[model samples]
Target: MNLYAIVLLVIVLTLLTVSLARLGKVKTKADYLVAGRSLPAFVLIFTLLSSWIGSGSLLGGAENAYKHGFAALWQGGGGWAGLLLIYFIAPRARKFAQFTIPDLLEARYNQTARLLGVIAILFTYTAVVSYQFVGGGDILHLIFPTVITADLGKYIIAAFVIVFTAIAGMASVAYMDVAIGLLATFTMLIALPILAHHAGGWSAIRTALPASHFQVLGDFSFVQALELFLPTCLLLLGNQSMYQKFFSAKSEKDATRAVVGWIIGTVILETVIVAIAVVGSVLFPTGEVHERPREILAYVGLHGFNGSAALQLLGALLMGAIFAKIISTANNWLFSPATNLVNDIYIRYISPEASNKKILAISRLMVVLLGVWALYQSQHIDSVLKKSLYAYTIYSAALTPVILAAFFWKRVTAAAAVTSIAAGTVITIFWDTPFIHHNVPAVVSDRDAIFPALIASVLSLAIVSLFTTPPTPSQLKPFSEA
Candidate 1:
């Protein structure tokens, strides 16, 4: 096998061993779903970092950087902005101590709101998983271009992620993330400077690319950049996977501390990712990567480190890290929606008295089913950058408003929360469709869904809550008093 393939094999083997070991620990619903609510701050930090900086950064954000340069940070900047707010919200999220964001919604709002939140999560998280598969396929194709095509690679990655996620659930996903996160963080950090050196440094890069590539907004308008920023910010604010990590913490302090580390790691790693892609764009200005910009990072991991034997080794390890990061992220996202279905929908509504074993079994089945769904979706996705934004918009516009209101706005009524959720979800889903585009005025149809969906959601929430009866002390107690 080639060096990249060998490194990938080693990573898969290590992940399998870890998953199997954790699988033996899964004897209860909480164990399988939330790592027995006992992950320490250190483990939580890496898991959060690994989960957040996935295909969205390595592929989609890199694609943006390749084309528009430093402006891609607008996407990463959104999460950084959200993380600042999350530092205060982390302890509160742990205080709520629920398995899913829907749990928090049900606790703070009502069952109908919880159901809507679950619907939004299912659509949003599954698409997130799909692009991770797309990214994984790209990695595999880079490593074994002669043997495995991207389409075939998608099936292989889907199977691997499904099996890994189903084996030990959250414990496996989180622990594996610790390893994958370290690999990626260290590899990318080390690789960037060397790649820059190979590319003749920042002076060379500035000379090689367009002037817009170095600008704040690059080639994009303020509206286009905002379109990138808002979805990412909204998604991070209401991210269910993140809340699940908080719920899995050993203590409120651990959860809060983890966010501090998570923010630092996210900032360092995301900036490094964009910088590497910027360097890669300088090295490979045209040809295959020019046609498929999302593959730039992997292309760099394969070609950018060929200066010496040692650098080639680093390149191979970097490829391994990218592949492993994609799997780690897919595991987290796939397991999250399964938790939603099991904890929020199945246990809460369908099988309240289900044995731990039955719930565990159903959870695995859900992972496989969702993996298949994500794989199917992967086939239809045209662009990772657009797909990431689309998925982010769905959750951000639909759920972020109601979620934030639950924690911060006591006057937000159940009726208003439900209306807001419905308004956001429906509008985001239809905003880009042919029907909306043709029927709606150009003024409305031309803009992204975030503007209209968020506007509708916020307006409905405020207007309805103002007209409707305010929540009672009991209804507000879980969020306010917790």
Candidate 2:
């Protein structure tokens, strides 16, 4: 193996070792599901950072940057906007102290809302997990092309993530994320100045690339920018993985403090990631990464520092961080849906009397099964950007409306909540399906799914709530306290 490959392998193996070390702590469902609600503010900060900055930002967001230059900050900006709002809600979420978003769903609305919320989460989180697998496979293929094609690499990635996730559950995922979080943060921070120097400083980059990249909107029209912005905003507002992290916090203070760090870290890291990709665009302007720009950051890690042995070592570790991050993200998104299945569906309905031992075993089984399913879907989706947005839209449309209303609008009846969830879920699924495309008007079919799905969901919620009876004071009690 080459020097870079050897280094990359060692980094990945070390992360796996970290995961295995946490296995003994996950002896109960509570520990496996929410790390026993013992995570302090510092741990929550990094885990939250690691989870959000995964394949979506590394791959999908980078691809957007490669194409659009700085204007691609629209994607990251969406998250920033959401985080501002999240600061106010994090304490409320921690104070509620639930295991999953679905737990909130059932508490605020009804059992039906909880079940539908699970369905939406399963679809969205699994799609997110699949692209993480695709991203990991891209890194593996970039490093070891002759031995492992991207197609085969997907299976390898799926197996490793599933095993690692199933082994330690949330406990391992959170702590391992702290290391990965710091590694990615410091590595990217260090790499950017070197990359900028290699690109001949800011002036050379400005001269070489199209001026559009530096523009606020880039090549995207207003509607196109909104298409990217809405899904990310919506997703961040209602992201189950994010809420789970908040729930895992040791106290309401911890959860609230974590969001403050999270806001600053997210803004810095996301912009840096885009900067890395923009510099890469100047270095290697055309090729497979140009064609499949999702791999642009990884491509740079392998080739950006070509001459110095020291720089090459840093580059290899950077590449390894990218690879390990894909694994961390997949573990998180995959483990999230499995938590929904076990904590929501299995324990809530199927067998309420089950032991923590059985729940722990079943959570692992669910992780394996969902990992296989996500692997199957990864074969069909062609673009990480498409999959990322599609997955984001599903959660945003189906769940964000009701979730925010639960925390803010006490008058929202269960009828409206249920209707909104159904509307959003159905509209998103059908808007992009082949059958819907064949039937809908050309203009409607050509538009982004987020507009239709989000509008349908929010409208149904508002109109239905107006027509239905307001929720009782008993139902309104949660928001009053919040």
Candidate 3:
């Protein structure tokens, strides 16, 4: 194996070792699902950072930066906006202190709402995991082009992530993220300046690429930018993986403090990721990367550092960081929907009295099933950029409005919440289908799913809430007002 391939193999083995070490601790549902609600602020910060940055930023966001230069920040900017809102929401989420978002959904709304929320999460989180698989495959293929094809790499990544995630659940996902997060952060920070200098600095880059790349919209219309912005913003505002971290926090203060660190980490790392991609664009502007822009980050990691042995070693570590982050993210997104199935559906309905061992066993099984499902999904996706937005739209449009309402709007009834979630979920799922395209007005069908789904969600919520009876104070007591 080459140095890059060896580095990646070592990173994967280290992560597996950490996961196996945590396996003995998974004795209870809480221990498996939310790290026993004992994660301190420091652990929470990196886990949250690692979870949030994932393939969505490293590959998908990097693709955007490769094509649009600084304007790719539009995607990252959406998260920045969401982080600002989450700063106010984290303490409230920790105060609620539940294993899953569905727990909070059912507590605030009805059991029906909780069930629908789980459905949305399954579709969304699994899709998120699928793209992480794709990114992982891309990394492996870049490292060992002769030995591993991207298609085979997908299965390899799928198996490893499934096994690692099933081993210790959230404890494994959370603790491993601490190391991955730090490595990715420092590697990106150190690599960006070096790559920029190697690319002949900012002036050369500006002269080589189009002026539109430097522009705010980057050749996109306002509506197109909004299409990119809303999904990410909405996804972050209602990301279940993030709220799970809050529930995993040791205290409300820890959750809130973690968000502060998360915001700083997210802004810097995402920006640096994009900056690195832009530098890579200048270095290798065409050929294979031009066709598969999503691989730009990995391509840069493999080829960006040249000249000295030290630089070559940095390249290997940078590639390892990308590969590691993809695994960390896949574990997180994969583990989340499994928790929903085990905690929300199985425990709530099928076997409330099941032993801790049985629940743990079932949780791991769900992870394996879901990993296979996500792998199947990875096969169908042609672009990581489009897949990221599609998955984000599923959760953002279907769940975000009602989730925010549960805490902010006293007049929102369970009926309205159910209606809104249903409307958003249905509209987004069907928006691009052949049936909708052939029958619906071009004005509506031509637009991205986010607009119609979000409008339907918000309008259904407001109009229905106005017509229906308001929520009882009893249901409202558990949720903290923001």
Candidate 4:
């Protein structure tokens, strides 16, 4: 993990990514962002899995598990629920041929709805990118401590992400993800079992840790689990990153196959990572573990398998794979919102006549700007899961219900859509504000932000749609035909 090795690995990966992106001949707007909507089943699945898991799943989920034991599984389970739900929604989403979530909203509702959706997306997705930078900085600092200072590490990571993302957008993201995902999957499958065996087996793990760490229900009450479950479900309902993957698929069959693959891949990989965290908890068995859960995977690399050089090499491979996952997720998430902003919002509304070449140039520039902003924000955030939850809640509350209504309920009018999105987002922000903090009970306050946001959004959608005039026959025709 010397400075030269780290730099060489990063340089090689970047060049490979850029080279693949150049192969695609991005002459049009579609090619630049969504790979001209031609991603095949395997590429789509890997990109979806890699993008969703990101730094949040690795660092954030592991940190939660280290601190609260088995309750952390709830976070990963939310994704499982989401993927199951997506099984039915994926085909339709692809049928729409929309570039972003806001594009779908704009097509079904109105420009006002699109604008509101964009606002929420930018806020939340930027926060998501911030956590990625934090994760990247952590990885860099861990591997090259003496040569790569923390400040320099953040800049290096930001530069790497920005450059990779700006080159041919989703084309680059998807192709690079194929390689990164395969590497990550193989490395995890190989390393985790070895790490566990070295840690002395299931019996030793159970003996070393408290009984609650293995509990299926965790320490949280049924009601508390419900609170956690609802937000994650809602967030996944209209996750823009997931939808983008659907749009990128080469065919309807590819989209469906990819989602099925995503479910299996996500479940298996997430379970392994969770097991790694649990094993680390058993081996370490101390309060200090909470502060450095990011190192749990790294710790395995450093100490998990001694004696055999083969085991140690497997450990190092796992570490590199984990690092790749973190970086890939960051690249995709950071790029998606900016893609939305540039194509869906900026090109559509700000300057409809802007040429594709100019739009492409601006999209690249935005990646750099976003990377710098994320790096600055990452300095203040300590918990990746909390930041991710906050971002997920904003998108879930404001857009999920409205997006679902677009597919199922023809009565959902533009006004209702706008109001629901506005009310949900505004209320959630207010709830988190200092003005209401003193009055809300600790139990309610401690729960995920999505609860209140979902309630407000759903109620507004139902109430407003019920009271107001429904869409005209023309508007209902498309949905009715489906």
Q: What is the C-alpha RMSD of each candidate to the true structure, in Å?
A: 0.9, 1.1, 1.1, 2.2
RMSD of 3: 1.1
- The lowest-lDDT stretch of 10 consecutive residues in candidate 4 is 2-11
Question: Model 4, 1-482: lDDT tens per residue?
Answer: 54325543864566465646565587787887778999999899899988988877788877767656767788788889988989988888887777898888877888899899988887777788888877777666766768776567777877878877777788888888887788888878887676677679988877877777778667777776665566567777788988888888887789989989999999998888888888877667654345577666655555566666676566656667777787788788788888877977678878999998899888888888877777778787867777878777887889999999999998888989999999878877677776666788877776667777788888889988999998888776655553
Q: Model 3, 177: alpha-carbon shift in Å?
A: 0.5
Expressed as tens digits, the lDDT of each residue in 1-482 for candidate 2 is: 79778977787788788888888777888899999999999999988888888888999999999989988889889999999999999999988888899899888888999999999999999999999999999999999989999999999999989998999888899999888888888899999999999999999999999999999999999888888888998899999999999889999999999999999999999999999999999998987777889999999999998888999988998898888788888989999999999999999999999998999999999999999999999999798988999999999999999999999987788899899999998888888778888999978888979998999899999999899998888777776797
State each candidate's clash count: 0, 0, 0, 0
True lDDT of residue 279, candidate 1: 92
Evaluate model 4: give its TM-score: 0.94
Error of 2 at 33 (Å): 0.4
Model 1 Cα shift for residue 212 (angstroms): 1.7
Per-prediction TM-score: 0.99, 0.98, 0.98, 0.94
